[model samples]
Every structure is written in structure tokens, then in C-alpha cells.
Target: MTPAVPRPASRPRLLVVSPNRSHLALLARRLGAEGYAIVTAADGATALGELRRSPIDLVLAELVMEPMSGPELTRAIREQLAFAEVPVMLIASRAEADPAVRAFEAGAEDVILKPFHFEVLVARIERRRAAAERVASMRADMKAMDARAAMKAIELGELKDRMYQLEAERRRVSA
Candidate 1:
């Protein structure tokens, strides 16, 4: 049998934020090997700053962190101007489902348990990223249209005022 042809991989820019140094290192290495350019942050504060300064396709945040937790970070990210639709996946070792639910409520697109299967995690991340991109693009277009409409309203108001002034001047001259 002929050897199976290997498919080329699409490298996605992913930000991996975790409070645990060892876990972060392992995740960064694994994801990087799987055709993802990994950016690491030790805490939510640093991750938020990095995300603002750079373009990130996806975010993987650990649920437990000092200073700020994953859900809190996700909320902050959602509040940002350009990143409202950016996909986020929260990671945690806790078996309880409440944290995951909380993360989703706080704006995380999904939650993955630690020691996650590689293929599953990658697939979920890719899907969320694509969906987020589509949503963000639509939102930007809508915002542009809203801005144009506001400008048109301002212009119409000015025109009406000008017409009234001209009518008043004509009446004064005729009288």
C-alpha cells in the first residue's frame, strides 16, 4: 500500500493562560506541536494585557488563578471593544461542573477539563474560533452602518435648520 499522504496543518494563534507553571509549559508545548502558535501568560492580568496588545485567535484560560480567575478574565475580555466575540475555552482540573457552567455564563465559549484529550480540545478550539470570527465580522459591519446612519441624521437636521432660516429671511424681506 502507498504511504498515506500527510495533510498540511493550519497554524492558529492561541493564547494559553494558566496559573500553574508546569501545566502551562506542557500545554504550550503540546499545542505548539499541533500547529498552534502558543502565547503563555502566568495569570489573567498579564493575559488580558497581552491580548490587548496582540491579535489572538483563541484563548485557553485555567479556571483557578491568583489575582484573577478564568471566569473573571473571560468577563473582562468580553467587555473589551474588539474582543467581544473572541472565543475562550476555560481549563480546570476540578471535577465539579459548576465552574464550567460559571465560565460559560461569564462568556467562555466552552470549558475543558485538565488532562484533556488533544484532538478533542483542538477541534473545539478551532470550531469556536471560526464561529467567533464570523460573529465579530458581522458586528463590525453593523457598527459601521449605525455610524453612517447617525451622520446622516445629523446632516438632515442641519439641512432642515438651514431651510427654516432661509424661509424666515425671505418672509422678513417680503414683509
Candidate 2:
């Protein structure tokens, strides 16, 4: 038998948080087709539980959920280090005054109104993933730089010790 081809990895995992079953199903179906591994949560608390259980690349939440609002969930997520870099977007079920501002201030990256275009939603998700990848790449570079600096510092210390030994030898010979 021919060797099975290895599959490429790295598809973004998305969590969709909404109380409405139909809305959740629709998002899961569309986004899954768009290449995201979809997970559903009934509310903010459930979303957080999912985050704790596994890592999520992005969060799409409904603005108005009972008990905890989307912004509140975003704040909670931001507080956790594992979820801090994950992109969060809020969707409003109804038009409200300054909902976008509220969501942004609370830590959501973007807010979409009701009846948003599917294309726009997919674009936003992709953009968020790209931005996150950039940030993670920068962080990795910084770590590598830091490691190099540490190694150079160690080498300099060793060089100084060798120089001290040479100076002592020279003094002894002169004596």
C-alpha cells in the first residue's frame, strides 16, 4: 500500500457563545465549512469552561446573554494568561446605543451588528488570526534574542576570568 499522505495542521479553533440554539448551529455550520474547528457554548460561563478545558484561537460571542454579558466574558478571558492573546468579537442581536464602544472597552477586538454578512464575519476571523500570529511570532523572536544575549553575557564572564588568570601568571613570572 502507498504511504498515506500527512495532513497539514494549524486550523484555527473557534468558540461560538450564544444562547440561541439556531444561531449557534448556523455559525457552527458556516464557520466549520470555512476551515475552523468549531466549539459551541451556551453562555459566557460555558465559554470560559471551554477555554479552561482547551485552548481556543478565537471567540465569537453574543452581546446579550443572560447572567454574563459578552464584555464581561471578554474581561474574564483577558485576565487569564492562556486566553489573553485570543481574539474576541461580539455580535449584537439588537441595535443598542454605543454597544460597540462598550464591547471594545471591555476587551473585544471587534463588534458586529445583527444580520451581519457571512463574508465579513469570515474576513474578520481571518484578520484576527493573522494579527495573533504576528504577535506570537514577535514574542518568539524576543525570546530568542534574549537567549542570545544571555549566552553572550556568559561568554564575556568566561573571558574576564581567563584574563584575570593571565594577569596573575604574568605577575608571578615578574616576581
Candidate 3:
């Protein structure tokens, strides 16, 4: 029998939110075909609910929606400590230059204008995902380093206490 091969880890999970159901479904299908695990929401409220339910690696939202727009959703996401670091990308039409600017101000990492190439969109998503992964890795490394530093500080304190005890004993014996 041939040896079993190891499977690669799961791809990133993406949350795609749009007011248009057909467009949302199309985007989900395309992204899914690209090997990303996708979750779609028809509006910001539903998207937030999904976010509260599970972890999402990235959020791609439409610029305009009822009640809550892409920038509004981004702000809400940023306000939540749990998802503050998740990268948010907004999709806007060519006419939405103003709102696109607002998206950046509201903490969107990237905004892709409509009538864009599929390849370009894919490239942008890949770049953002890579950056997010690097940030996460760095954070983990920093946490590990902090733990080591803390442990060393504790060791140093213990050693100093022992040294003080030894000095006191010597004084008592010498006396």
C-alpha cells in the first residue's frame, strides 16, 4: 500500500456582505472556487450576527447598503475588541469616490472599485490575507518573548533573595 499524504491546512474563512443577494452569491461562488471558505450576508446586521457567532479571517463588504454601509460596518467591527484586527475590504462603484474615502477613514484596509478585473480582486484579497497572517505570527512571537522575559525576571528575583539570605547567614556566623 502507498503511504498516505498529509493534507494542507484549511484556507482562510471570508465573510462577504452585500445588499444584493445575487451579487453576494456570485462572489461567494467565485471565492469558494478559489479555495477560500466563504460565508455570505445580505446586510450588515446579518454580517455582524455571523461575526458574533464565529471567527472570520477577513470581511469584504459593499460600500452602500440599507441602514449600515461598508464604512459603518467597518467601524462597528473595529469597535469590537475581538475583531479589531480582522482586515476589512470594501467594494465600491466608480461613482462612490467620496464614500470610498470615508471607508479608509473608517478603518477599511482596502477598497476595490467596481468594474474591476477578477484577477485583480483575487490578488488584493491574497495580499491582505498574507499581511494578516504575518501580523498574527508576529503577535504570537511577541507574546512568547514577553512570557520568557517575565520568567527571567521571576528567576532573577528568586536569585537575589537567595543571595540576600546567604549574606545574612554569613554575617550571623561571622558575628
Candidate 4:
């Protein structure tokens, strides 16, 4: 009998990355109230480590920060295979068009303008969560396909061996 395949991990926790202590704290508080497990990081390096240590569902990052800008952080996250599939949202000031565009180019799922209303932020967060779930579903489907393919390959190898044995028997009998 074949063993059952283990299911994927649970819903991912959210990570808020920004160097600004007040901004990160505020964002965490607001999102945390919305029933999300919020994690905070002060820089791109810390963010990368935090993501590696834990499963992150989504990332909301500021466009401008010390050491690494929002786009830089996004690049860092994308470099890791585990996070390459994760959805990212960039927080940028309204006046920064170039940075916003660059954020999207750098692999942000969405660009959220700064000074946004709490409700607006909440709605955006919900939207991001939905997007992330869809991506996760796609990944799961791909994995299932891979497992099936492996099983098929094994079956084919077994069939080849059986055919070889049958041919050998026919030759001996006919000889």
C-alpha cells in the first residue's frame, strides 16, 4: 500500500519590513488586528533572515529605507527560492513615481501609496492575501503534478522490465 502524501504547510504569516520603527510598529498593529500574525524587520538583511526562519505569506515593505530601499529588499527576497513565490506589496510616497515603477519592476505584486487610510490599508491587505492564496494553490498543483509524473516514470520502468522478460521467454521457447 502506498503511504499518503503529507499536506502543505498552514497559512503563511505576514512580514512587515521597514527601517522606520514607528511605521513598522503601526503597520503591524493595524494588520495584526485584522487577524494576521505580523512579524517586523528593520532592514533588508533582517527581513531575509526572518523570512528564512519562518514561513511568510506576504511582505509589505517601504520604498525608502536605510541600507536597502524597498526595491532592494524585494530583490533580496526574490533571490531566495522559498520567497520567490511569495507576494510582495511596496509602500511608497505619493510623490515617487519612479520608485513605484521600479518597485513593480523589482517584483512587487502591488504598490501602495503612503499616507493611506487605515480602512484602505486593510482592504489592500485583504486583496494581497487573496492573491497570495491563489499563488500558493498553483504551487500545490504543480507539486502534485510532479509527484504523479514520478510515479508514472517508475511504472514505465517496471513495464520495460516485464517486456524484456517476456521477450526472453518467447526466444527460448521458439529456439
Most accurate candidate by TM-score: 3
Each prediction's number of clashing residue pairs: 0, 0, 0, 0
In candidate 4, list every pair of residues with a backbone clash: none
Please provide, for model 2 over 1-175, each residue's C-alpha lDDT reduced to its tens digit, 9 standing for 90 to 100: 1222232486779999999999999999988877788999999999999999988989999988889999999999999988899999999855687889889999999998988888888888888888988999999999999999999999999999999999999999999
List the candidate numbers ranked by TM-score, top first: 3, 2, 4, 1
Instruction: Please give, for residues 90-113, the per-residue lDDT of candidate 3 as tens digits.
Output: 999988658668999999999999
- The residue pairs that clash in candidate 1, if any, are none
TM-score, model 3 to reference? 0.93
- Choose 1 or 2, whichever is better by lDDT: 2
Give Cα-based local distance difference scores for all models. 0.86, 0.90, 0.90, 0.83
Q: Give the TM-score of each candidate.
A: 0.72, 0.92, 0.93, 0.82
Rank the candidate models, highest lDDT first: 3, 2, 1, 4
Q: CA shift at 51, candidate 2, in angstroms?
A: 0.5
Candidate 3 at 2: error in angstroms? 31
| Runs in model 3 lying further than 4 Å from the true structure | 1-7
lDDT of each residue in 1-175, candidate 4, tens digit only = 1222232345337899888899889888867656677989998888888898988888888988889988988988888887897888888898886877899889988888877877776677678878778877898999999999999999999999999999999999999
lDDT tens readout by residue for model 1, 84-171: 7678899877775688788988989899986778778877887897797788789799999999999999999999999999999999
Q: What is the lDDT of residue 148 in candidate 1?
A: 100
